[model samples]
Target chain A: MSDIDVAMARALLLARRGPSSDPNPRVGCVVLDDAGEVVGEGWHEGAGSPHAEVAALARAGTAAHGGTAVVTLEPCGHTGRTGPCTAALITAGVARVVFARPDANPDAAGGAQRLRAAGIHVSQIEDLGLRTEADALVARWQQAQDLGRPVVTWKFASTLDGRGAAADGTSQWITGAPARQDVHDLRADADTILVGTGTAWTDDPRLTVRDRRGADRPQQPRRAVMGLRGLRPGSVLERTGATVLDTRCPHEALRRLWALGSRHVWLEGGATLAAVFWQARLVDHVVAYVAPAFLGLGAPAVADLGIGSIDAIARLRLDDVTRLGDDLRLMLTPTPDPTEGA
Target chain B: MSDIDVAMARALLLARRGPSSDPNPRVGCVVLDDAGEVVGEGWHEGAGSPHAEVAALARAGTAAHGGTAVVTLEPCGHTGRTGPCTAALITAGVARVVFARPDANPDAAGGAQRLRAAGIHVSQIEDLGLRTEADALVARWQQAQDLGRPVVTWKFASTLDGRGAAADGTSQWITGAPARQDVHDLRADADTILVGTGTAWTDDPRLTVRDRRGADRPQQPRRAVMGLRGLRPGSVLERTGATVLDTRCPHEALRRLWALGSRHVWLEGGATLAAVFWQARLVDHVVAYVAPAFLGLGAPAVADLGIGSIDAIARLRLDDVTRLGDDLRLMLTPTPDPTEGA
Candidate 1:
């Protein structure tokens, strides 16, 4: 394979590290000898383990001399649980290094500079395809690091007209089965799932990640409920494992989750709770699964957001749109532009 | 080109006939001689014109003998303003015929059967690409013929959150200039543009078809207002020439327009008027231009449709989703399932 093909493969390997690699970016490495044959491959499997470059170098051993390393992310220069990858590569006598994405973390950045200082050839591949894949895999962690809070993704299921439930509150299945399955996949990517106390009492949902076969996923997001109201005893959420916080503030809940080393938080609350997050300007992303039906009455997907006029309304930037069965899923993010203040 | 390629070319020619061919399907034909060289090409330019096959046969003249005809639609077997195209093709001694789509109109079908019985080589291309193109070009007129009423396309511009205006009713430019330009394109395709009397009094809009250059288009849909209330004498829609119906009934207004040979109606009324048509089951199509901005406290795109509960909500089938500048344009149609009751 060419350098880009090998980098993309390394990106796939990095992604295999899964959501367990929170608070740290997933990294993958492949060592190639003089003949461009892959001699060893390794990924940063979990926290407090050997760095991907160090693991790859150990496997390559003598083959690492006068060889090139292709990595999904730029090698880290900072020493954490393991030694810095840059020092290990130089110690292994690596000749060249090619990476798909630059490590955005300030402490881990300077690997290219250190390698070049040691007279090693270091190249950053501007391949958009592989770089995009690697960037998306690390976006939540990067956002958490940049914003100093857990990146919150607010998810809701609504009718095509934006109604979340009927006047009588009968919203058993707004979207079909395929869209619900997609939500489970989304849950698997987050480290925490949160709902309001009203939802915990009304729906009594056990927010565990489950696959299509109804089996528990290997990694499940920690279930959390936020609100002053206490949960009913022996409720599904209370019976099944959920962290009940006695606070109504969205930021406080996020801070607590961040303290617990959560990088991503999926919020699946009702309209009133969504408005609270919107008012607090804590919602980073919005995922709305719009079913192909209309409820002229019932409830709006989001309650009045303290927006009495049009100019005060919060605007969301559209990221992606997909059709899942008869439903349309729209992924949006809070606009980065500060002029449109939340 | 192969037969399918030649048929696709004919479909493009048919589309070139444009929206002027309302009340009749646009069609194009190309005749190829035994040597496989194109002999003639023609398209149905207007409703009263000779059918595509007859026009092509006229152009081919004696060159049509022992030639194959490629048509966007099957040759018409029934007579209308002109003689049957199938009889003309057989009289012209065309040896073989290939068509992209079969004639679905009840009065116009049986052309393939007649050709086969007359010892002519008839082939249906079954090319979904070209057939879909031709079918969409005539869907409104075909639906009108089937339902015996003008096909109503209810169009409304809203914010991304589905608000039609601000709290103070300032809705001058909810969508960007590009989405408004697209609305004019939609208007140019319809035979009538209808609004409520309240909208006529409040907005005073000149519902004329205009191009991007701000010049009036060659053809304009007739402006119509449906409500019991009278329009202000000096209003734009009143002074600019609009038909003010005396009745508040949606069905009565549609009957009047259909009697005037209108095949498609573009409804751009306010919330109340839309609810009337929706509840009456008169709205067949919906075109929602969703702006990227939000207006939480303005007007909802649709009002109550007597849907007291979620189960009674009207469901729509998604047809198209498009981006116009920073806005989203969604084209949808009412679900055809009988259980939906609309």
Candidate 2:
């Protein structure tokens, strides 16, 4: 790998330390002295915080003079609550700058051009080897920005035979404790947790991220229920201050969620809701926890998505397979169908 | 490891080379000289062929005198088509004999006692570390002999959602080529392939073992269908000379299969039959090939097995998980429930 790739990987790791629920993209910066030694590093904490370049420059002090700054995202040229990061780097006397991903937001883009205009050397991390890691640092934010909607991740826990609940609807537990903890982790990473009104009425899930001891985490994702039917009057969702989308169409619900500043949506379904999202191709990622048990009769994990024959089956590429206790967690993404129009 | 353990492991490997469909146990023998160097190796060919000990003895000739004989199974004292292996070993003048597993068949057991009575130094492979490996060598045959029924292995191919077919009943294939080939390999290892009459009438599957190139293997397992209803007229089963076990009970079907000399029975089902076997606790082993695809509506891989709640779920311990092309092959065994009586 090139020197820039190594610095960008470190920058990505630092970026992950930032709050994922923030509307703004996470960014990390590393400032190097003239001798190619890292002098300072900083990551954006959340919205209204100092930009990564400004934070790094403050830590670097005089070492920023004639030095290089490596960042996970391009230094912003447009000012928001804080001044433009390009001006900060220029004022700090940094001679060279390297970035992993270019800022795609129209309002904050063109930092690379501004740096070049100021006669400072600017380069992007162009190594193909570091592209995936670099892109993943801001993949969900980038996707949400590109599509004008929250990136949806559909999650479910089911038996080996794909039953989500038993015949009598008693599904208190399907996956083991470890898998459930992993799901809580997933919930904590998202900006919103969504379910259908049917789930809200039938299950009345608290929809709160919790620790192993069952204590609710401080920064819980915003809970929301979609569909025209209203939740039960005494439902847990009503007590938990969850938003009611009041729309049967998945597109409208996602649009409202995007408007509500939800960049990533965790979709917990009751089969029928999942089918609608899948049928409309709204699901971006799938996380399935399959327990090594057989419930020969129960609610199927997913309802019909208009598939009638084998040729119409929804194919997914298995990205990762992990064993969490006795349950197998499968991470998958839909493979693009050549027969379907974009 | 002990020298005897190494020799017995080699003997087990040689034993596996014999035809699994043979009524007699596959036994291998290795004759070691006084210097602990192998002088000869032999495995029983089939029923009419010489026993493993006699074959090794014939190859050892004069070298057998004052040497050691390592066999996978105890040398038989009574003979059917050949002279007693004990008599042959005594004539060969072997000083010591080590066997991995004792013969359990009533007609052929007591070989160890006979060898001791003849004043030969007899030793059994008693190493705890090699017990599982040794037991697996003859597990199916021994189980059949002990239970008076064939050892049943239930095999099925399904989508990740536990679907066996599409909504339109069009399921030409669920798993990929590699998983299908693995199923054929499983069929080749079993003595019989049993399905329900409903499957025979609906699918009319050609239950024959075949190679990768679509050529029928010379040694195919016996195909049989069990149910009260008769098979459809002029089905593939009729053309393939499959037997009809006209009984709805899983126990009766297994009993008839045992009477027909089936030691290992591979149960390939179309949902209902699998549920019956599982409900009866007749499924000793399970092999599930899960394709990384979703069929939202289809025939489930298994029907209702009388479980109404999560507490009644049939749990299994995953023994092995393997990736076959794009599909996953899971090998599992039933976990004993403490609440249920044996």
Candidate 3:
């Protein structure tokens, strides 16, 4: 992207934050007048706010006439968080609409059609950075919805053979300090980090962002334990400023969370909880980091979520596969419902 | 494990490999007399190469009397590839044995039991490096075998949002150079790098180790393309020394390739190929590297593998997970069989 667009994208990114947007992409839109000053500015903050276009038009207040509305996502044609974004844009009298990404969710994927149908000038920059930032949380949320849960990513580090820690739990560092810190940064983007009480009890991990720079540390996504009876006084979570979602009944817990506000969640494993989430169909992504080391043998395999047939499947389509530092990371998303096959 | 066992455990780790040695661990066994001279060394290469114990005993020859053998994995009692390893060890007259990790596979999970039953000085060393390595790979493999396929890991690098490539397809460097090299190393461990012809034709990535210092660089692994048809002479495969496996029939093709000497393979991505492997129950493990980035609206997805019911299932118990520098990697294997759920 050009320097101007990059700055514009980041600014728009900062504007979009969603409470209901957990697992949903946080999007923002801005309309620049012919002279390049901001004519209208709006963002999708939390779930039920007026979408970017509506908010931008409302903020523009007659100044939107003949101005080009630069949007992060194609204006929505459906009434979701609010009314049709395309209609909003047209009613606001914007001369043209410049969008970085099209509405990706099928429900929202038709924004471009609606805008063009309304006879407004619609131009898609097809900028990648814009769309990527636009859909981070929402896309994963979409996958989770389509496939029945969140995208499950198993992140771990192992030796040449995949191992997390040595037997006896003396695993202080395997990949290196840098790699551990890398995880901290990752935790920042996650909506929540789901670890079993066992792991929290064993490691006493603070479960908060550390080993990074700037006050812009992780968003402090919610922290959770699998079982109902693991919260303790001396636990790592004792004073960590985070919410603990008890997921003994993960499906219901996730539903509660989704209803309240939770977009993505990370499963810190010990088998039982991983299985819980798996069975509950709550795990959205699986990030397994096989450290180039081993723990001889200790913890049990993440408990089985009782997946009987492939049909009771909590599906994840392998989206993109790559290698981390001496590790492999797999990206996953849910299979769409209709396409999930009857 | 105890501190005394850590050293021995590290030594045992040399044996483990990626998922697939189901019911059997990748093992390394060392035999020495009371004097502890390098009497013999053996690792589980795959099916039917002298089992580690037998190989070690055979190499020990007549000097096997009154010796202590340190093994990465516990010696077996039942026979799979050869006669019971415990029986062989006893017949060889070894006096004592030290194992870093106990055999978890049911067939050999009782190796320690058998060794103890034989009245030998058998010791289980805690904190064995071998344990961790074995756990990571075996968990997924066992899961896959039990569930009928390998694990699934998705690796993709985009924005924090989960975008893969830009709209215009200008994916020059989504990740840094080090990150790219890291991917090659991961591929090295893999038997194949499965991808669609679209990726092959577009970037013409060598898909081989360009960096020499990495392990995968020394001895390159196979590059197996999914849609291995319709190649132009000047295409990437034309110059790149890689194999093109037809995904039209994933199972049959894999079997054919196995017949053609493919011991392990890497499944590169292309939606069709991923879908085929996933649907056909051939994917044994999925190593996904997810970059904290996103690309909106590129390709629909990597796979639409025509999966119908969960009953067409190939499920995996979440095995090992970790974070790789600014990215997440998930190493997954299929769920293990009920009879031998490790």
For each candidate, give the interface RMSD after superposing the true interface residues on Cα. Answer: 2.0, 0.7, 16.7
Model 1 residue A34 CA deviation in Å: 10
Task: Work out the iRMS of candidate 1.
Answer: 2.0
On the 0 to 100 scale, the lDDT of residue B38 in model 1 is 80
Each prediction's TM-score versus the true structure: 0.80, 0.90, 0.43
- Better model by DockQ: candidate 1 vs candidate 3: 1
- Which docking band does candidate 3 fall into? incorrect
Which order, best to worst by lDDT? 2, 1, 3
lDDT of 3 at B258: 55
Which ranges in model 2 have alpha carbons more than 4 Å from their true place? A1-10, A31-41, A58-68, A78-83, A104-109, A124-132, A338-342, B1-10, B21-23, B32-41, B47-49, B58-67, B77-83, B102-110, B124-133, B338-342
Error of 1 at A194 (Å): 1.8
Worst 10 residues of 1 chain B by lDDT: B14-23
Which candidate would rank higher by lDDT, 1 or 3?
1
Greater TM-score among 2 and 3 belongs to: 2
Model 2 residue B25 distance off true place after TM-score fit, in angstroms: 2.3
DockQ of each: 0.40, 0.77, 0.02
Model 2 residue B289 CA deviation in Å? 0.9
Q: What is the lDDT of residue A336 in candidate 2?
A: 75
Winning candidate number (lDDT): 2
lDDT per residue for candidate 3 within A99-198, as digits (tens), equals 7666656665677766677777888666666656656535666666675444444444433222234344444454545556667766666566667667
